[model samples]
Target: MTSFLERARSDIGTAPIAALNVGARRFSAHRDHAVEAFPAMDDMRDRAREIRLHTLANLDRYLAQFADTLEAAGGDVFFAADAREANDYVVQLARARGVQHIVKSKSMLTEELRLNDALEAEGMEVVETDLGELIVQLAKDRPSHIIAPVLHKTRFEVGALFEEKLGVPYTDDPIELNSIARRHLRPLFLTADMGISGVNVAVAQTGSICIVTNEGNGRLTTTAPRIHVAMLGAERLVPSIGDMSVILEVLARSATGQKLSVYTNVLTGPRRPGEPDGPDELHVVIVDNGRSKVLEGQGSEILACIRCGACLNVCPVYRTVGGHAYGSTYPGPVGSVLTPALFDLDEWSDLPYASTLCGACLEVCPVRIDIPRLLLGQRRLSVQTRTGPMWMRRPLRAYASAATHPRRFRALLRIGAAIGRLFRSGWILRLPWRGAAWTQGRDLQTPAKSFHRRWKGRNRGS
Candidate 1:
């Protein structure tokens, strides 16, 4: 398999990278404007953070309350320990119900579980109802970003994809593209036997799970199908409706700068007596999938992420390489901390190093996750475990030694300055040995005189 860095390097100046840059910048600007417009933004963010941390701390109690409430309201709750258990529960439910077609409403949890592949293996046709998800599904591509699944693709690329996949005339117009998707998905929604969605925030008090979306697919997916299975992460819960509302206040503004999403559906359970449109059976798969381990570990606060994708919009690395480069279900600054914390650190050690430690993600995060601190923690863990890049070890060891001793540091600085002065151009075209990678893209500047030398010279004259 290709490495994360390799994938990122390959897409540097590609069309997808260009598209990602434009979309991320637009979303970042909108979020800034939205935050500026909201008078209580800072206070709301503080409240949201408090709510998130509080809920996580008491997650066990809330999960039990939520399950009991939902189960009493004619819904079933399955606590899955991992991906296999989660997929098996959903597949078994489909089999028992004789479900032939499943329409999904952009559930990242399902993506993480690779639910579609599992269902397809069981001989069921699963369709993505969200427009971005539908486009990626049709193109047989994975989601690049959390909120905007196809952030890497431009309209022209989407048009081409639709034309080839749906046999429609190629049109780069977004309106026409949406129309094509709507026409194609309407029949599927009506025909699908099951609907799967990811929960934004679940209210333990009312047993209601919120699904925020920009399109009507969320509603259709939940209502049109006879069975609605919500793939909910265990951490995505609030103590009450008020807590859920507080999270909603920041989610949309941080995500797309909207006061609220176009469709914020709160479903308590299956259709009640005389309900007009809703599924007959409601299943909530409370997937743990390493979350329990995460909750017990150093990076537990990462579970507080609401999947707003605001951090991705502001991250310089994410903006340049897009989501595919991260090579995980989640990407960007949050992903750098999350993927490693939730999975094997040895495999994902490179992710934490991808950042510039600029703290842009924290600045834009609605819940104030302090992603940079988490990232540094991950990097520290990687080195402690000896799972980080082997090449960096020697250099960092040397740095540590020199930095701890003032005399050695000064001597190294003098040597560096002497080497720098050897080049009259004031720029090193390439560094020796392993450092060639550093100057490959741009030349390294010559080092100026050390501060110690300047201070000493001025003092001598005095």
Candidate 2:
């Protein structure tokens, strides 16, 4: 199985950031925004963490209550056991309606389940409504950041993508570029047969799904279409609207440094006869995918994540490789635990190790998830499964044996030091096979001979 980093290295390099007009400086802007947003992000993350932790600790009551509230409000709710099951439920609904077009607001869970691909396979044209997501979709690319899909790209790059893909007059100016996207997506909103949205927070008491965005596109997508299908991870649940308010406070602040997003939409069932705008049919697909496994395991905190991208901004590894390097829709420290815990472990085993075990992600996490702790635990599991390089096993086994027999370990170290003195230098003269992978991008500076050996020789000469 390939490590997550290795896979990321391959995919992110190849994926489109700024196809034509977009430039690499998209990453620099993301860094600037993150720094500017830090204060609010911190406060929001703390609030979000507390709310999720509180809810998770008492999940059963909340889940049952939330389901009841949604149904009572006239919304149809379907709980799916996994990704395929969730897609099947949505597909079945879409097919039953005999509609093909789908316009979706940005939702990472949708990407995780590859919902657009599934819908497209059945001949539906899935339109992305978020600006950044729209850019990536136009470029035929995957998202690179949690909040900003095209974070690794710049305005000029987006301008280029628009020129080539959208066939518009080419200009890299931000306002013109945004206007172009707005024009492009305008028709799809009205023409789409159904709207698909990702729920940000699910209120257990009222059975409402709250979606926040800067653009009003979310409202349009949920309203214009006759049928609206909302796909949400099961973790979105909160016991009450009041609790949702707290999470929302943190969510907006952490995600964009705003006290609140430009739009915070709370939608219950379908539109009542008197309602001005809303779908006639509202179907909520509560997707468990692999989330239940986390709920049942040591990863319950990971589910506490509200999809805020604060962790991404604060992560060093993320800063270096950007989101694509994680090779999962979710990136940064959050991806380290989430991708593996929710998906294939063997395929994603390297994600946890991609970190320097830095606490930046945790520090910025709205829900204050112990990300580094969880990442290390996942790493241990990977090692136990022998999912990584073979050489790790040899030293690990030797270390274990050493701990069991102290004297033997000491003697081995002494002997090794004696040998090291013969060819010791700042740079490694020779390396054991196990250490070769380390030399790929670095020169390992060798340690000096044991101080005790040098001391004994000096005393005899004196």
Candidate 3:
């Protein structure tokens, strides 16, 4: 199996790398400008963080309240402990409802659960309606960015993909490309029996689910089908609409630099008696999928994330290597802390190190999650569990030993400087062990002399 460093190296100097740079820079600029324009940005971020903290602290009460309110309003609420349960419930519901045709908006939960694959295995024709998601689906590829799924692919690449997959006239124009996608997906939405979506915020007070998006697909997916399934992460809840409003405010500015998304559809229940365009049956799936464990752990603060993707845009590591290198559903500074907390620490140990811990992510986050601290926490856990790579142990131990003694520390530094001087190229191209990982992407400049030596020489001369 290829390592994260290996995958990251492959993307460097490639078209995808260029695309990542452009996309990240554009989004980051938009966020900065939006925040600059809004004088209440700081206050809103603080409020949003407080709301998230309160909700997480009392998640059980809110979850129960949300479920009770939704159920009382003729909507079915299912609490899923894991992915298997969530997928099984959705699949069984589809089968029972005779839902052979399914259309979905951009749903990160569904992606995390691999819902499309599961439904497809049961002979359902699952179609993605979001433009970026459609492109990803047609190409059988994963989303590279959380909000902008196809940020890694250039327009030309998308044009080519559409041309090959949809058998359409090749055009790279953004407007024309969107038109083509709309032309293809509109019919599917009209004919789909079920529509699946991700809930951005669930209001426990009113039992309403808020869907935020830039495209019309979110609305169409929810209203177009007879059966609408909204997947809500157990942690994505607020006590009331007022709290939801604060979250939405920061989410839009942080995500796309808008005061509001083009569509912020809040659906309380299934169609009312007089409603013309609405789903006949609304099902809310509250998915745990290890989130409860995350809430109890050192990384509990991560549940406060609003999926704004602000961290990704401002993150240097994410900008450099892009999302696919992380090999997880989520990516960037948020993912570094989240993936390991949600999944296996040993398996995803590399994710925590993906960051430079530069604190760029914390600066941009809407909920103010301390991602660097959480990353360090994960690293500490990995070491305690002996899950970190064996190569790292000895070096760390040697450093720890030397750090406690001045003479040994100086001796080690002198030896390192002497070895560094042996390299004539002025840079160490390759390191002997785990240091090879560091040298892979950048050159380590050779040290001419240790700081101790220079200090001693100056003192003696003086």
Candidate 4:
């Protein structure tokens, strides 16, 4: 119900346009060319799905390999079973190193767990360095979309959010806005004690962590701090950098319609003895949370998600209601299936039903995840258990009985239609609770008897 999520307001200071630029680019790109734009990239979705399924099947093996290689590369690797445990590990490490200021790249896993809020609650000054995330952080707004956090904000709205929240002189020019953001965050990037980033892919063989971003903040976030920490969902691991290449090939093109992000950094470990610029200490947090559980269940197909946000771009429901209506950190169709599978289904019962059973999410999925199937699965589970509403359950049963029972159902439908014919002045259902709600607003013509009745009548030559 809150318009914005609770994050530090000081984070987006003076750079409201950063939000607008990131948000605008996503909306505009999708607006102009979404379903039609990525025709060439469709096969990549199948490839990505195969690779993810393969990796998940061999997850334990791949995980061990990833951690061992990181250890071999002088990177400390810690595996936490859940979000609380994962953030605790990072906080303890930061406190041990006497770290105060923290800068972070965009990471959805953190947002899912509200990790930044947890860190801030512990009195750590955590800053989101991604331009969109930075704007949302300053505006105290939850991300409207995963890939682009401020996707719902218009430039004018962003300018106003900046002026009202950041005390910046309001301006809407894209170039002017970007300059202000860069100028404002330049100092924070340099001064931060440790940097946190999300891993796009973790190469098990090379022990390298990869990140892709349009802005250079990810580079600054990972390298500038003395200590660098990267947290990833356990599913993010790929077998090797070779496997990583296939994902990267599809990730950007599917996500932003670009061949590559402006910054694609692969970090192996701590700064080598002779290396000029890198973190002195590198720590990788592999958080299982509910992902291990996710990989085990029918809903596991969601794990194949590479988070391109193409699903959001094409979903009619997502476009209409937006992400906030989903009421989870992860929203849209992916969120509809994922959040409940990973968390409590009861808490998110409304979410699964929020969809129109549309297949747009699956169509645009770079991994070819059958999102609509999973959503329907969730709905069936919820409905069977009465986790949904009495209103739905009662009417659906009556409808089901009527459809399944032939003669009785047809007779009842005929009676209902005959009664409805009273309101039909020239087939216009212009009647003013129950059926009137449909009739009063629009033309609700009663069917000319039941289809089965008509079929029987025609068969008998009645």
Q: In TM-score terms, which candidate is top?
A: 1
lDDT of 4 by residue, 384-428 (tens): 787754546678888888889899787986788778667656366
Among all windows of ten consecutive residues in candidate 2, which has the lowest summed lDDT? 17-26
Q: Residue-wise lDDT of candidate 1 within 1-462, one digit each (tens)?
A: 566788888988898888888999999999999999999999999999999999999999999999999998999999999999999999999999999998999899999899999999999999888999998898888888889999889899999998999999999999999999999989999889999999999999999999999999999999999999999999999999999989999999999999999999999989999988899999999999999999998889999999999999989899888899999999999999989988898998889998999999999999999999999998899899988865566789889999999999989887887887798888899888868978988898887666887799789957
Candidate number with the higher TM-score (2 or 4) = 4
Model 2 alpha-carbon drift over 4 Å, by segment: 8-47, 388-391, 398-445, 448-462
Q: What is the lDDT of residue 397 in candidate 3?
A: 84
Clash count, predicted structure 3: 0
lDDT of each: 0.92, 0.79, 0.91, 0.80
- lDDT score, candidate 4, position 306: 83
Instruction: Show the colliding residue pairs in model 3.
Output: none
Identify the leading candidate in terms of lDDT. Answer: 1
**Lowest lDDT block of 10, candidate 4:** 2-11
Candidates 2 and 4, the one with greater lDDT:
4
Per-candidate TM-scores read: 0.95, 0.86, 0.94, 0.87
* TM-score attained by model 3: 0.94
- lDDT of candidate 2 at residue 25, scale 0 to 100: 37
Candidate 3 or 1, higher lDDT: 1
* Candidate 3 C-alpha lDDT tens digits along 219-262: 99999899999999999999999999999999999998999999
Off by over 4 Å in 3: 398-410, 417-455
Candidate 2 lDDT by residue in tens digits, 153-263: 677788888899989988989989888888988999998889998989988889899988889899999999999989878888888888888887777666765667898
Off by over 4 Å in 4: 1-40, 400-411, 419-449, 455-462
